[model samples]
Target: MFGKKEFAMSVHHRSARFLHHHPVAQVLTVFSFWLIGEALVRVLGNPLPGGIVGLGLLLVLLAMRRISTLSMRRGAGWFLSDMLLFFVPAVLAVLDHPELFGLTGLKILFVILASTALVMLATAFTVDRCWKYLGDRKEREHA
Candidate 1:
């Protein structure tokens, strides 16, 4: 006969193991957050896209320690690894627009390249600052 404590622990262990083994469930968990964001947007009549809201929500949850990074690691890794696939539709859609091959297209391409460079630079700077801040915090804690 199993004790109550043992039974609860057994259930928790089984659930943790199931989550660890099932990447699909992890992805669904991520998607559920997005759906929640979409519902919130619909209810609040916000102008921002659901995906952006969802990402912000996820970030806040992670920052506040409400969610463990490990819980989202596998799903986020899969999405990041296959991110190029997400842009395939946009690339294909460009073929349907003949004007994009002309001077207007060149201008758009230039803007895209410039914006990408700016975003990369900004991201690099932010990451470097965050790294330094974390390193300093750790050093202070140790001291």
Candidate 2:
């Protein structure tokens, strides 16, 4: 019964209201889902890290339309806006390893660069495959 535009507007309106009056609830909801995902990972005894598993769970929820990302967007935005703050501790910890910057530093730097390049290449390939699969699926559906 709901038109797509109307449904989208209603979702937007609900999200705005959530952001305005229940921001804490929104944050808690996100945290709770992540916590549940972490629990699932632990219970399954999977090698994958809890954060990654949690993210996968969140992605599934979003894709299935079981949850609206609008509620989490503001809280995520707030955290990302101050993302540098999260890196401060890691940077400081890296400074603690003065030995890593000596002769072996060049080797370490090479490894870092190589690993970064490989990761980028792998991510690009994965994205390309996923895009092609999605495009093919759409074409088949239309046909």
TM-score attained by model 1 = 0.63
* TM-scores for candidates 1 onward, in order: 0.63, 0.56
Regions of candidate 2 where Cα sits further than 4 Å from its true position: 1-21, 110-143
- List, residue by residue over 7-96, the lDDT tens digit for candidate 2: 998997886676556667766766776788789888999888777787888899889986677767766666668889978888777687
By summed lDDT, the worst window of 10 consecutive residues in model 2 runs over 15-24
Best by the lDDT measure: 1
Relative to the true structure, how large is the alpha-carbon lDDT of every model? 0.88, 0.81
- The lDDT, on a scale of 0 to 1, for candidate 2 is 0.81
The global Cα lDDT (0 to 1) of model 1 is 0.88
lDDT of 2 at 114: 100
lDDT (Cα, tens digit) per residue for candidate 1, span 32-65: 9899889989999999999889999999988998
Residue 118 accuracy (lDDT) in model 1: 100
Instruction: Kindly report which residue pairs in candidate 1 clash with one another.
Output: none
